[model samples]
Structure formats: C-alpha cells, structure tokens
Target: MPTHHIVSAFDEELKYLANRIAAMGGHAERMVDQAVFALVNSDHGLARQVVANDEFLDIGQREIDEKAIVIIARRQPMADDLREIIGAIRISGDLERVGDLGKNIAKRVVAVTEARQPVRLFRGIESLAELALTQLKDVLDTYASRSIDRIGFVRDRDDQIDAMYTSLFRELLTYMMEDPRNITACTHLLFCAKNIERIGDHATNIAETVYYIVTGAQMPAERPKEDKSHKVTAQATAAADPS
Candidate 1:
C-alpha cells in the first residue's frame, strides 16, 4: 500500500542519518587520538594533520543538520521518529565540538613542540588522554548500538577524566613555580589538558543524547562533577599571599 511504502522510505532515511552520525563519531575519535599522540610525541606534522581534518568534521555537521531538517519537513515525524532525527542533530553538534577541542589540542601541541618540556609532564597528559579517548569510543559504540544500559557507564567515567585533569593542573602549576623557564611549556600543556577534559564532557553529552533517543525522556539530573582545578587555583593564591 502507499502507507507501507512511505513508512519504508522513512525508515531508510533514518538509517542513513544514523550511519552518517556513526561516521562522524569515528572521525571525531580519531582526531582526539591523533591530537593527543602529537602532543605526547612532539610531532608537529601529526598536529597539523589534525588541524586540517577539522574542516571535514565541520562539513559533516552541516550535512547532518541539513538531512535532519529535510527529514523533519517531509516526514512530520512524531514521538520516537522525531527523537531519532533530533538525536542525530544533537550528536553531530557534539561531535563538531569534539573536533574543535581536538583542534585546540593540536594548536597547543605546536606551541609545546617549539619549547622544551619535561617528559614526565607529557606522561600525565598522555594518561588523561587515554581515559578520555576510551570514554569517547565507548559512548560512540553505545550510540550506534542504541544500548541504553551502557549509557550509565559512559556517564560515570567523566568524573574520572575530570579528576585526572585537576591533578594535572596542580602538577603543571608546581612545575611552573619551580622553574621560571618551564612557564611557557607548562601553560601550553595546561590548555591541552583542559581540552581533553572538555572532550570528555562532549562524550558525556552524547551519552545523554543516546539515552534520550532510546527512552524519549531526559536524563534524571546533571551528572556529578569532580573537577577541582578552581580549588587548586585558590590554594595557589592563598600560598602567594604575604599577609
């Protein structure tokens, strides 16, 4: 019947949209990995590649937005169908932000490479990157599979990434305080660490999107935050006080 054919076509469009989102997620993940690798290895070439690849992510986001709008206009989807299209748009936006964060890291990598830095500092950054990358990969997989059960696991991991970043911030501050020459390198590394932390945040946002797509309900509340960088800054200020 005509209705059956229309339903089939709508399903196909949804599938295509889902596939595009998955592809975007993969690119975002790879960019994060490469940006961190460049930072750890001082590979300016790899950093440049990450910066260049951001254009593709931008294009991907635009394409997804276009497709979502067209589908909504033509299909007039309701409830779950509407959720699916909306989720794609939201996820693509988050992935675009992920790309931008990776680009920020790449920019920092270029700066750090120009200045000499200690190897141990890189080790801390690399460890945080690994955890953040894992979160991103797992959340993308959850989105593709529509696995609501796995969403909680991905959401919980953001705190760990924040904790790691806070620790790195403190350590970098100490390094700068101990050696005047280390200020430039440590400042750049601090920014890179913050970018990685933000990527974890975007991954968490994607996880929430997955939950909404599956259940058609908002997440219960905001996830608990563990970032303590502000506290560390306050401690530093107190220590510097002459009074």
Candidate 2:
C-alpha cells in the first residue's frame, strides 16, 4: 500500500475505534440504569439480565484493544497519533471498570432480593444512580463531540454523586445504630451506593481523559466550592435555602 493509503487507513481505524468506545459507554450506561431500576423496583428479571449482559461489555473492551494493537503495529503511528491510540486504550479500560461497577450494583440487588423484611427503601441509591447516569451520558457526549466545556460539567456533576453517597452512608449508619435488625439490609445498601458512586468517579475520569486529548493538558484537581449565601441569621430566619 502507498504511504498516503496507509495513513488514511490508520485514520479510519482510529475513527472506528472511537465509535467502539462510544458504543461501550452506551452499554455501560444501560447496565447502570438497569441495575438501579432492578433494585428500586425489585425486578429479579432485570437484575438477572444485567448480570448476563456484562459479557457484552467485556467483549467490547477486547475489540477496542485488538483494533488499537492492529493500528499500532501496521501503521506505526508516532507522536500525537500514538497518543490518540494510547488514549483509546485507557478510555476502554475505564469503561470496563464502569461496567464492573454496574455488575457489582446488580449483585447487591440480588442480595437485597434474598434479604426478607427490614428492607428499607433505597432513596439514596436512586439519587446516586441518577447522578451517575447523567455524568456517564455527559462524558460520552464529550467524547463524541470533543467538547471541552462538557468535560467541566461532567466533573462538576460528580460532586453531586459524592454528596449523595455521603448522605446515604450517614443515613445507613443511623439505621444500623437504631436497630440491630437494620444492619444487614443497610450494609448491603451502603455497598450498592458505594459501587454506583465509584462508577460516577470513573465517568469523571473519562471526561478528564477527553479534555487531555483535546488540549494536551491535564485538567486541574479543582472541585466545586460550597454555596454559603444562605447563612442562618437570628432575626427573621429564612424559610429555606436554595442551592
């Protein structure tokens, strides 16, 4: 093949690899949403389906890796092209981790199904799942569009997931303290929320990777600051504080 043809083929491979990554992300998002839906609705069938679908995510990760290796070996891309190839590898790994997290959440759903009585409603889990889903979608969008602005939004949304996780932990701790009977169910709920929150973090990691690929610069470690405009005053206490 001519040199021009080889470069064109290499570029095409990179494009296809990116599409595969997006497909992987889409599957991961579905896994998470299905896991949460199962937990909240106590749908045994959905939980089982999520467990079975995990294999697809694994297959996707493998495909992306295989294609990347083929490109590296055949094209021998250098510099920025090499970085793009490596970045796809890293992104696929993160997507696999997110898939694992979803599977973990599904396992927790199975545990919840086994436990009879003392099953508290999983409000915290629902909130965390929603936040994670939003972040996951946003990150995938950044990847598709190569938009730096969306990356910042994805990172900012992570704070909401973390706060929900913290709140869930505190609530579960209270449950465990109040009634020893609550310990088993609460512990499982805690683990489920933790898994979902970790998934959100992984999504943020992807967003950071996207930013790096676009600008060749790492995103800062900065976090969103708390809004403190609603300080309670002794005189005429405010009815509420809106974030």
Best by lDDT: 1
Rate residue 166 of model 2 by lDDT. 65
lDDT against the true structure, each candidate: 0.86, 0.77
How many clashes does the backbone of model 2 have? 0
Q: Considering only N, C-alpha and C atoms within 3 Å, which residue pairs clash in candidate 2?
A: none
Write down the lDDT that model 2 would get.
Answer: 0.77
The TM-scores, one per candidate, come to 0.93, 0.85
Per-residue accuracy of model 1 over 1-243 as CA lDDT, tens digit each = 012335688888888889888888889999999999998898999999999999988999999899899999998989888888899999999999999999999988877878767689899999998998999999888887776786777767898998898889889888988888888988888888888898999988988888898898998797878887766753435432111
Candidate 1: how large is its RMSD?
3.7
User: After superposing candidate 2, which stretches have Cα over 4 Å from the reference?
Assistant: 1-6, 115-120, 223-243
lDDT of 2 by residue, 158-237 (tens): 87787676666666667766788777777777678778877987888888788777777888878553322234222464
